[model samples]
Structures are given as C-alpha cells and as structure tokens.
Target: MAMYALTEVTKRFTKGRKEVRALDGVDLTVADGDWLAIQGPTGHGKTTLLQLLGALDRPSSGSVLFDGDDLARLSERRLAGVRARSFGFVFQFFNLIPTLTAQENVETALVPLKVSAASRRERAGRALADVGLADRSGHLPAELSGGQQQRVAIARALVTEPAVLLADEPTGNLDEDTRDEIIALLEGLWKDRGLTLITVTHDSTVARRAPRIAWISKGKVSLRKDDRRAARSRAVTTEPKDADSAAVGGAVATAEQSAAPVTTTEPRDAGGTAPGGRVALPEEATAAE
Candidate 1:
C-alpha cells in the first residue's frame, strides 16, 4: 500500500517581490515499509518535499495524499493530529532540550498525544533502550557524546510509535564513525518495526544505503532503484586496511553497482524553472516539542 502519494505538488515562497518555487510539480509515491533516500543539492527543494510529507508545511498547489487523505485539503488541526500520531522526525542536529535529561527529552514527544506522565516515562525509557541509550537516560545532552545525543534524539522520535520516520540530514553533523553507528541503528529500527523510512541527505554514502533513491534537482524529482543488497554483500566479503577504508570501499562498491543498468522513473514534466533566489528555511521545531 502507498503510505504517501504526492501528485503535482508545488511549494512556493515569497522572497522580496519575486516568488520562489521550492518544489515544482513533484510526483512521487512511497510504499508502506519502504526506505527512500532523497538526495539533492542545497536549496533545491529536498527539505521542502520532506516538510510536505511530514505535514509540517502545506503545498502551494496539488495533492499530497497520505494513506488516501489529502493533506493539502486538511485543516491545520487535522494536520497537527496526523503529525502527532503518524510521523516521527529526526533532524541533523540533535535537537534535544539542553536542560532535560535524555529520558525527559524523549517523553516530550508523547505529551502532545496526552499520554499519562507515568506511561510517557515508561515508553521513553523503552525507546532509549531501543536506541542503545538506556544507560544514559539520566544524562543531559551536554553530558553525552555527539553519537549518544543523536541516539537520544532518535529515541525521542520513536517514543510515539509513529508509522513513518522522516529524517533530514540525520548524520550530517557526526563524524564518519558516529554516522555509521547511527545509520545502522536507524536501519535496524526500520526493519524491526516495519517503518516507512524517508531520509533526506546530501552524503552519497548515506544515500546509497537506501533501497530506492530519489534525486531531486531544480525542484524536479527522479526515482531509481538501487542494488543495495548486492553492494552490502560485496562490502562484507571484501577486506580493507581499516574501518574507514572499509567504509570508503563499500561506498565505491555501491557507486559501481548504481552505475549498472537499473529501472528509473521521472516525474511528468520534470523540467522546472530555476528560482531566482533561494531562501534558507528554519529547521522544523514541532517533532521534539
């Protein structure tokens, strides 16, 4: 079943006197339990598209169907309900409240759903354990390492038991080693929980991990199926000098596999007019709060 279906979706922003179209006539469908990686240059509408999917923002025109309901037509209250109950989001920066303990940070996600305090605490504890952060539940974000803080953020996102996970630049701020650890954790969670995972990343290494890749350019999108299974097999079987070398080798192998013939689907009228200027939007603040 299709968890999300976007047809002729376009998002526009008014900057000065000129209108900037971040997403132009985008058409894409993501199936339930599918993993989709979106990669594109900065200011090219990757985040705009993700915002639409997560119900953080509405489109300027066209339909954004989530499980057959048109999000564009929904009232703001209904959209907020959908976001609170159906979607979980992890951002690039660990957006944990500095004063809150790890468990407390996670519990906040349940507050909007009106979960009892005791139940929220219990669920938050379990979520931290799921992300391998149970031992650090009492620690503040300042006390934890970058990787641990990201884990706490992940835990917070999952505490609501959302059906879809929307992550934007999830590993962009971490070291390569930490990035790998976080990605592994997310991949495991997606498989075990049957989550519909959608991640937007600029890193090719991260993008290649997904079974399907959506390349957005000039507010247009193209979808391609990747042979990640074969690439993973090659990475595991090959021996490298060190861990870093192994990762690089794996990326190379994945790139090679991607170069091979694969099925690709491009949106109708994919060509879009380039924006005269780009506006940097603020990070999404709803997920953790």
Candidate 2:
C-alpha cells in the first residue's frame, strides 16, 4: 500500500483581482521510504503541494490520505498531532529563533512530541552534532553563518525522528559550497535513516535524484510512469483557470518539469520564518509550557 495517496486534489486561491490555480486534480501515491523530488518554477504551486502533503492545508477538492486516513476528515487538532509525530519540515531559510541558543531551537520541535526535557535535550544535542554543530549549540542564531544555522534547522527537524522529511527549496539560500554539503547530508540521512524525503525544488540536478517524478499543471498532476502518454491522459479533468488557482493557494500548476525556470519568489521573512512556527497543541501532542 502507498504511504500517501492523493486523488483529484485541487487547490485555489484569490489574489488582487485575479484567481490563481495552484494545484489541479493532482493524483499521486508516495510509498514508504521513497526519495521524491517535485520540480517547477517558484510560483507553480510547488510549495503549495508541500503544504497539502504535510496537512498544513487541506485540498480544496479531492483527498489526501496518510496511510489510509483522509486528511480532510481530520480535525485541526488531529492534523497537528499527525504533523508533530510523523512529519519533519525543512524550509530554505533556517527558521531558528533569534534569541534561543542553537540547542534550544532544535529542542523546540521535540516539545510537541512529548519527549522528556532531559531526553529531548540529549537527543537534540546529538542531532546537532551529527550536522557538525556540536559546539555551536549554545550560540545564538546571529553567531552562526547561514549554512550553520540551516544545519541547526536540519538538526531540529530530525531530532524528532519523523517518518517523512518535507523540504521546500532547502538549498535556495546557500552558496555553492554549502549547498552541496547540505544536499549530501540530506542524501545520507535519506539512506541511513530510511526516511521518505519529499523535496520541492526547481533545480534539475536536485530533481534528478528522485526515483519518481510527478508534474503539476493547470489543475492536474501527471505521474511519469513508464509510458509518457499515460501521464497526459490523466489530465482530462483540468479545472477552469478561476477555480483552479484559488483552491491550491493561487498559482497555475505546471506539468512540464523545467530543469530551471524563472519563478516569482515568495516573500520570505527576513528571518526565514514560516507563517506558523508554533505547532498547535492537541491532546496527542505533548506540549510543555
């Protein structure tokens, strides 16, 4: 059985007097322990698809099922539980807290999982060390370079030992030297930790690492199985422009995988922080004050 199955997924949103179709009738099944890469221009709903997969947002239509449970049916509380216990997210910018020490920042992601304070601290330290940041744990974010901080973020994401690592443009901010290092680290983790790594990137080199590729365009997703024609046939149900954009977070989906294409970048916070930093607490999530 597939680890995740998305069927007829459509998402749309409205912008300034314009409707954007971010995802359209997307269908995919990501099995366990698979390394997958999603490629497209910046605004082509790559990030939006990640959001849907991570259950940060529900599909406007269709279904996203984890194991066998439909994410749309999950309450906000349940979704938070699933995210905390099963998913690890890595954004391009290291989303560490400015005032917290590196170790403290990494420890934050573990809080939701109800790990004991002492155990969490120990595990967090080891995870940071794994990324070659053992000594910097006590330092603030400003003290570290961009690459160091991002590694700390990676450490935080992994400390929880989540089943899936969802990274969106994780290498976008680094220079060539650091970029390759981070990629190698991720690949190593993918192999050693046996994680399901799903990354969204415009870089062809990055996408090529994936064993399977899925393309999004219009309001549909095409899976590139053995036959290219079968992929095109799946798009017969693409939605109209208006409904398509507004539903999946407001951009046209593109099935044509571009090795590199110009994309209107999203407004990244100067701090590289995501919109929702705190994982909402549910009963299943262990939250400490």
Candidate 3:
C-alpha cells in the first residue's frame, strides 16, 4: 500500500520581495514500510520536500496525499492532529532541552497526546531502553556523548508510536563512527516497527543504505532503487509469514525495477538559502523535534 502520494506539488516562499520556488511540480509515491533516503546539493529542495512530507509546511499548489487524504486541503487543526498521531521526527541537532533530563525530553512528545504524567514516564523509559539509553535517562543532554544524545532524540521520536519517521540530516552532527551507529539504530527500528522511514541526508554512505533513493535538484526530484541493498534485505528475510506479506514483497521488487537517474556525486548541505528556524509546532510541543 502507498503511505504517501505527492502529485504536482510546488512550494513557494517569499523572501525580501522576491519569490522562491522551493519545490516544483513533484510527483512521487512512498510505499508503506519503505525506507527512502533523499539527497541533493545545497540550496536545492531536499529540506523543503521533507517539510512537505512531515506536514510542517503546505504546498503552494498540488496534492500531498498521506494515505488517501489531501494534506494541502486539510485544516491546520487537522494537520496538527496528523502530525501528532502519525508522524515522528528526528533532526540533525540533538534538539534536546538544555535543562530537561533525557527522560523528561522523551516524555514531552506525549504531552500533546494527553497521556498522564505517570504513563508518560513509563513509556519514555521504555523508549529510552529501546534506544539503548535506559541508564542515561536521568542524565542531562550535556552529560551524554553525541551519539547517546541522538539516541535520546530517537527515543523521544518513537515514544509516540508514530507510523512514519521523518528525519532531516539526522547524522550530520556526528562523527563517522557515531553516524554509522545511529544509522544502524534507525534501520533496525524501521524494520522492527514496520515504519515508513523517510530521511533527508547529505551523506552518500547513509543514502546507499536505503532501499530507495530520491535526489532533488533545482526543485525537482528523481528516484532510483538501490537494487543491491534490496536484494540483501530479501536474502536475510526469506520467509514471508503469509500471502499478504508475500504480495507486498513482490510489489516492492516490481517497483525496484522502475529506473531513474542515480547520482554518485558527493552529498552537499541541501539546507539552501531558505530561512532558518525550528519546525512549526504547537507551543506545548518541542519545535525542533
């Protein structure tokens, strides 16, 4: 099943009396439980496109269909509900609160859900454990290593049990070893939780790990499948539990054969010249996470 279908999507921004078209007539479909890595040069549309996918920003003209609903037409309240219930996000910066303990930071994700304080703490603890930060739950972000802090950020993202995990430059701030560790953790979570994973990254090594890679340049996107990675995934998980599982597997294989350009160029910042700020969220929600 397709988790997201975007068609003719365009996003425009006004900066100092000039108009910037961030995304230009993009059409793409992301399958459920699919891991897609987006890469591109600086000042292109990678982050803009990701913002659209996460419902952090609306398209100027066209449909962004999550499941079957058109996000472009949804009210802000409806969009916020979708964000709160369906999507989880991780960012380049650890984005943890300076004063909050790791546990408290993870618990904030549940605040908008109206979870009781006790329930929030319990779930946050479990999330921290899942990310291998159980022992660091009481530590402040500054007390943890870079990798551990990212793990805490990951825990906070997953505490809500969202269907889709949207990450923007998640490993940009880490060293090579730490980056690999975070990538492995994310990969495991995507497979174990059946998440629809979409990551915007500037690292080619990270992009190659995904089953599908999407490259955006000059506001347009092109997609290609990573056949070698897909084959490896199939080999490791041979037995489909049921007919439905087998069918979905077949569909993914078929989709992989559809060709598009594959870029071997080194990844660039992709942050572009757009304005910088945290993702838009309600006051109670952590804007950066």
Candidate 4:
C-alpha cells in the first residue's frame, strides 16, 4: 500500500506584505516498507515535506492521503491521536528530557499510549538496550554521553511502535564517529522493525544509505527510485570525532552551524528529531519523542 500520497500540496507564510511560499505545488508518494532518504540542496522543501507528513502543518492547497486517510480533514484532537499512535520521530540532536532519567525520558513517549508505567519502563529499558544504552538508563541526561543521550531519544521514538518512522537529520549533532554509529543503528532499526522510514538530510553519508531518494526543490518534490548504487558505492560512513565539550550541545547544536551551501545540518535543537529541513524552515517543534 502507498503510505503517503501528496497532490499539488502548497505551503505559504506571509511576512508583512511579502508572502513566502515555502512549498510549491508538489505531488509525491511513499510506499509501505520503504526506506527513503529525502535529499536536496538547501532551500528545497525537505523539512516542509516532513512537516506535512507528520500532520504538523496543513498544506495551503492540495491533499495528502496517508494510508487512505486525508490528513487535511482531520480534527486537531484526531490529528494528535494519529501522530501519537501512527508515527514516531527522531530529532537530530538527542532531545532527552533533562529532568528525567534515561528510562523516564524514553517512557514519556509511551505515556499517551496508556500502557502501564511498569510496562513503559520495561519497554523503554529494552528500547535503550536496542540502541546500546542499556547500562545508562538509570542515569540522567547530565550523566550520559552525547551518543547515549541520543540513543535514549531513539528508544523513546521506537517505544511507540509507530507504522512510520520519520527522522530529521538524525545524525546532525554528533561527531563523525557517533554519527556513523547512529546511522548504523537506524539501518538496524529499519531492518529489524520493518519500518516505513523517511529521513531528511543534506549529508551524502546518510543519504547514501537509503535505497531510494526523493529530491525536493522550491517546495516541490521530484522522486527518484531504487538508488542501489549509492547504497553500494557509499558504504563507508562520514564523521570526524565527538567534540570535547558540551558547548557544542547547547544553542550551537541546532541553533547555528548549518553545513555548507549544499550541505545541510540535521536540526535537533527543538527536541523534535526531524528539525533541519530544506523545503521550509523547520517546523515549530512540538513534543519530544
């Protein structure tokens, strides 16, 4: 089944007398069980597409059919229900709750599921374990390493068992080594869980992992299918090393430090995993995980 189909979607923002159209008339589709990498130069509507898919924004025109349901027609409360139960996200920076333990932070994603707290705690622990953070679940974000914290965020996202997994620059904040680890982990998750995955990135390293690439420009989507060459030719990961200080983790993490003209940084500062999008300005991030 097609997981998402966009027809002539458009998004515009008015800045005083000047009206900005972030996404132009665009049409696209993503099938079930597809792992897609959304790639484009900056100012292309990569993030805008994610926002539309996540139901965070309504298109100014056109309609998006997700699993046969029109997202534009959903009520606010009903939309929240769809997002809560049907989709999960991973931000670029680990958006762990500062006050919660790794376990508690991960469990937060499950709170709305109405599962028992004990079950949440258990599942959260297992999710952390899946990401190689089993030993750090009891620690607070303060006590864990950058990679470990991001793992917690990933765990929280996975806890929901959503049908679709959306990641915005899932590796933007970490050093090269950590970035590679994160990519490997995502590939593992995609395989193990059979998720319908979509990630927006300007990183060729990350883009190379996807079997298909959807390039967006000026709020319009141009699709590319079955790009196995990138997956095969770009097997090695790109990353340097972790920074030595936490200064890299604060405002500079997602606030600044975008990659070059063609390079896009993963925006995770808002705690919404899918943050540095090319199609539009990153969505006003909602809840974490």
Q: Pick the candidate with the highest lDDT.
A: 3
lDDT per residue (tens digit) for residues 1-289 in model 3: 6889999988887888988777878998998888899977766778778888988888889999998989889998999899999999888887888899999999999999999999999999999999998999999989999999999999999999999999889999999999999999999898889888999988999998888898887677777555544544574668899999999988776665443346544334445453322355553232231
The regions of model 3 sitting more than 4 angstroms off are: 226-279, 282-289
lDDT string, candidate 2, 148-218, tens digits: 98899889889988999988778888887888888888978886787888987766666665655655444
Give the TM-scores of the predictions, in the order they appear: 0.82, 0.76, 0.84, 0.78
Reference-based TM-score, model 2: 0.76
By TM-score, the candidates rank as: 3, 1, 4, 2
Off by over 4 Å in 2: 16-18, 224-289
lDDT head-to-head 1 vs 3, winner? 3
Q: Better model by TM-score, 2 or 3?
A: 3
lDDT of 3: 0.83
Clashes of each: 0, 20, 1, 11
Angstrom error of the Cα, residue 31, model 3: value is 0.7
User: What C-alpha lDDT, on a 0 to 100 scale, does residue 243 get in candidate 3?
Assistant: 100
Candidate with best TM-score: 3
Off by over 4 Å in 1: 226-289
Error of 2 at 106 (Å): 0.4
